[model samples]
Target: MNYYDGSFGGMHLIWWILWFFFIAWIFFIPADIPYQKSKKESPLDILKKRFAQGEISKEEFNEAKTIINSAT
Candidate 1:
């Protein structure tokens, strides 16, 4: 076997395989650009929504809001 044409010091095509993954990482964007804005519901806002939906009465909503605000 010729030494110059051998499998890169007996390693079978390692450089090509490494380059393939390196180039792929540059284009992968699941955690990068075009970020998604997350909507965080505040305690008071959530209480108001529940009251509007009839999940809780006005007195209950006011009680919960006062408790939440006093705690903070």
Candidate 2:
């Protein structure tokens, strides 16, 4: 109610813009961050684990490993 003075006091447009983005980040950032992360195992790494665990013989492992390497 102090319009005679140039006092928007605590409510400026820039502050509103900043608060909009800050509140948006509080709600949206964490879930979006997990999707942005590379949480997948590489083909070579998976293959090595399989070989180590005796899921595949050395010959099969080497063949699959070669194919994985060449494709990348």
Candidate 3:
């Protein structure tokens, strides 16, 4: 009805360390996973993407880019 063998050879301590390390990683990692929307792109970057994707005309892109640059 007991578990302690008195000779774990540090395995028990290693398990505790690994458990804490996993918890730290879960909380501290940024999770920069793609398609997860973990990162936010700046306005200019979004505008560039729009232009490249043909979602906006060249002149429109230029105007928006100018506005974003001046605002910053």
**What overall lDDT goes with each candidate model?**
0.81, 0.86, 0.88
Better of 1 and 3 by TM-score: 1
TM-score for each of the candidates = 0.52, 0.48, 0.47
- List, residue by residue over 1-72, the lDDT tens digit for candidate 3: 877677766878899999999999899987686468656798988899999999999999989988888999
- Give the C-alpha lDDT of model 3: 0.88
Which has the better lDDT: candidate 2, or candidate 3? 3
Window of ten residues with lowest summed lDDT in model 2: 30-39
lDDT for position 1 in model 2: 65
Which regions of candidate 2 are displaced past 4 Å? 1-38
Clashing pairs in 2: none
Number of the top-ranking candidate, with TM-score as the measure: 1
Model 1 TM-score is 0.52
Choose the strongest candidate by lDDT.
Answer: 3
Tens digits of per-residue lDDT for model 1, 1-72: 656754365345777788888889767846734667767999888889999999998889889988999999
What CA RMSD would you report for each candidate?
A: 4.6, 5.7, 7.0
